[model samples]
Target: MNPRNNRQVRLRSRPNGIPQAEHFEIAQVPVEPLAPGQVLVRNEWLSVEPAMRGWVNAVANYSEPVAIGAVMRAFAAGRIVESTMPEWPVGTAVTGMFGWQDFAAIEPAAIQRRIVDEDLPISTALGVLGINGITAHYGLLEVGHPRAGETVVVSTAAGAVGSCVGQIAKLRGCRTVGITGGETKRRMCIDRFGYDAAVDYKAPDFEQRLAEALPGGVDVYFDNTAGAISDAVLARLNVGARVVICGTASVANWDPPPLGPRVERHLLTRRARMQGFVIFDHPEHTPIALEDLAGWVRAGRLHYVEEVLEGIDSAPDAIAGLYRGENLGKRLIRLA
Candidate 1:
């Protein structure tokens, strides 16, 4: 039987910088009965993403700010326990913006995509087969347009999306370089993710090391963190280079968008092309991306890791931890 109440992590206030556990409050409200066209989903895994930082902030980003005092918006994987709609039968697994709650009473439209690969773990729907994987695929191939024998550089290289990007770039016959935080993640980028070279941005000689790693210059750059690190990579771009801006993780505040990047002069000099990519803008192509990601996983060519924090209580500090590079892989909150 379902629990009597739904325990949730609700947003209490917006943060000026990285959101902390103190910004949220955990509360239990009685679960409402399922209404017409609604399904009761017992959310099992809550995805923790860097993009979530934009969600809670006062910034006007790709999506509207998650309202104050509302349930924290999140992508979660779960099973449908009770459904009023025949199309979504009970026992069906689903994933979508199910919020940071254990039980969700939501309409059919609330389900973004159903969990389809029975062989893969359900948690993957919120990780490898979910946002991170899809983002990596589209951002690299479609936007960056990496070619064989070219050098492809990725920022946040050992993290979920960057890791996937490095591996995919390698499979496409490109020489891959990873730019990450520390020695530990640097090693993981090379030893685990199959990058040709990995550079630690936190190192005192970061620029020198990064230049050494890219002797041929960057042909395609998949940038996840846009700050000083990106500025260094921009200077080393080969002619006709392509840069795909996937996220701006290093910037904490976007009250006014950062402008006049030093990279523009480099772009003009090298005849390079740079563009921003947000997956939500291409909903028509999401299914195709998912199908390819699943195929890669099943064939053993693609590898992904999960850094799962036990229990709903972990949701509060999760976004802050993500920005800190505390997670080595895709982070998730396991609700049991």
Candidate 2:
């Protein structure tokens, strides 16, 4: 049964630096009837990622900035409960940019992915089997291109995308070193995610530890946080190293752009290639990504973590929590 009111987390104001809990408010509005080629989806899980910081900020990203008074744009997984569209009939499980809402009356074109692996957990569609997996697959393999027996260091290594990148690097027979914030995640990198070694960036001896972790120097750097940690990694890049720019989590402001170590010298001396990865730009790799990621999940070759918070009200504070490094892995709000 379709709900009458749609509860959506609406952007009340654009933030100066990072999105805060106060910037959003949940409002329940009457669900509109489905128009032709439109489907009503009951969003079961809402995702909070590092990238949402850019979406709500007053800056141009790959996508347009989230306008004030609009539903806070986000990725969510749900089921089609009602449809005027044949492609997405009632009860079809799907994932899309459905925003932070309980229900959505969206056109079929809005659906980013059609959930094919119904046997797996529905939440995977938003994470490992979704953008996270796709981004890691292409960014590392296509962009970073780690060869077997190379040293691959990943920042934010225990995060959703970073975790996947670490595992995939290992699967390619590469030596993996994970750089994360806390001691807990550092241990998780070694024990849970199968990293050869992990360094805690918050530690006082972080540079020493990172150096020890990479005695032979870095062949591939999977960068998620582009700040001080990246500078350290950049300083130690091996000749012909590849740097994949995935996310800039630690960057507070990019309007005038925060100044840091110049990357040109590093790139020139190491003869390395650094390229930014926006997952939407690599749609051709989706099928292989979904296939291999799903197969790995079933075979226990890949593992994922999800920290689920309950209900729509949890959505507002979730993005801010992500910036604070509160969640262990992919953070999703589960609707009851």
Off by over 4 Å in 2: none
Clashes of 2: 0
Q: What digit string (tens of lDDT, one per residue) describes model 1 on residues 13-77?
A: 98876788888989899899888989999999999989888888887578998888899999999
Against the true structure, candidate 2 reaches a TM-score of: 0.98
Clashes of each: 0, 0
Q: Please estimate how well model 2 matches the true structure, expressed as its whole-model Cα lDDT.
A: 0.92
lDDT per residue as tens, model 2, 80-134: 9999977678999989999999998889888987898988999999889989988
TM-scores of all models?
0.97, 0.98
